[model samples]
Target: MTLGLIGRNAGRLLVPLIFIFGFYIVVHGHITPGGGFQGGAVIATGVALLLVSYYYRDCLERFIPITNFKLVESAGLMLYICTALAGIVVGSGLLFNWLNASGGLFGHPVAYGVNPGDLFTAGTIPILNFAIGIEVFGALSVVTLIMFAGLQEKTQQEEDAEAAESAAPLVSKRKKGKGGRK
Candidate 1:
């Protein structure tokens, strides 16, 4: 069963805000209290809210499908691993902070203390955060969608079984038949 019209409308209205908040958390991980993982969880929570507000089949058709989610999850994991491997290529060890102080993209050095945070600093932290965020979002969203669909299928099967039982004819237990065991 799905939520009423008001709930659905509310969920639809909140989706963009939820996504923006999640992205904000991810992008500001280095300067704030949240990170990629937390941001992704927030995004997944939004997806869960959508699932609750609509029917599973409708969600599958209208929003992110399970297949697409799986693909995105796989791509995110690959990208994260590739980002880590980049450190090895640069001779800085695996996942080493190579981009710091390099004056390149995301390579600015941080000042000594009590300074304003630079968005382009922190080396590979931002990249890794993005990768992890996408991975977590896709994984959790897909899992929630699949579980909802599974439960719906189970309920439908049970209902079908009940209907079948109700439609079947009842036979008397005391029928005298020639094939009866004596």
Candidate 2:
């Protein structure tokens, strides 16, 4: 995802749109071919695009808190667990499709319809998709951050080494030029 070509420039402009599309894919996953893992990876590419651009990359890290990533990850896990437990409490097997019955927001006995394999259909699938999405995004962001930090550290070390080498010979020459006159 290095930024230097026409394609990369074009991608920078398209990244936000891609992210939106990815979310749509995840949300509609029950009806469609795509799911949380695939959509989350696509969304991560949007962040990779920004990182590669080199413009405002440092500022991005400052504005996005790492804590937010951790919180999202934790919340996703908890939601998945609680949802599975709800199935058990209702006498449905763990992760059983209790929400599969149609027409009621709460289990209040509205008209029952068969699950349509669509987004409007209720079940554990959508909730699980959301959980995977959050986990994947958080993990990818942390990995990218660590990689950039390592690169920056290597760059700084090289610069410091060069500066020390340049200064050393100059100091030695000055001493030789001044004392040799005696």
Give the number of the best model, judged by lDDT: 1
TM for every model, in the order presented, reads 0.80, 0.68
Please list the residue runs of candidate 1 whose C-alpha ends up more than 4 Å from where it truly belongs after superposition.
153-182
> Which tens-of-lDDT digit does each residue in 93-130 have in candidate 1?
99988887789999887898888788898988999999
Worst 10 residues of 1 by lDDT: 173-182
Cα deviation in Å at residue 139, candidate 1? 1.5
Name the TM-score of candidate 1. 0.80
Worst 10 residues of 2 by lDDT: 102-111
lDDT of 2 by residue, 51-101 (tens): 666433344556775667677767767887888889899755788878665
Q: Please report the candidate that would top TM-score against the real structure.
A: 1
True-vs-predicted CA distance for residue 69, candidate 2, Å: 1.8
| Candidate 2 wrongly placed segments (more than 4 Å) | 1-12, 55-57, 105-117, 153-182
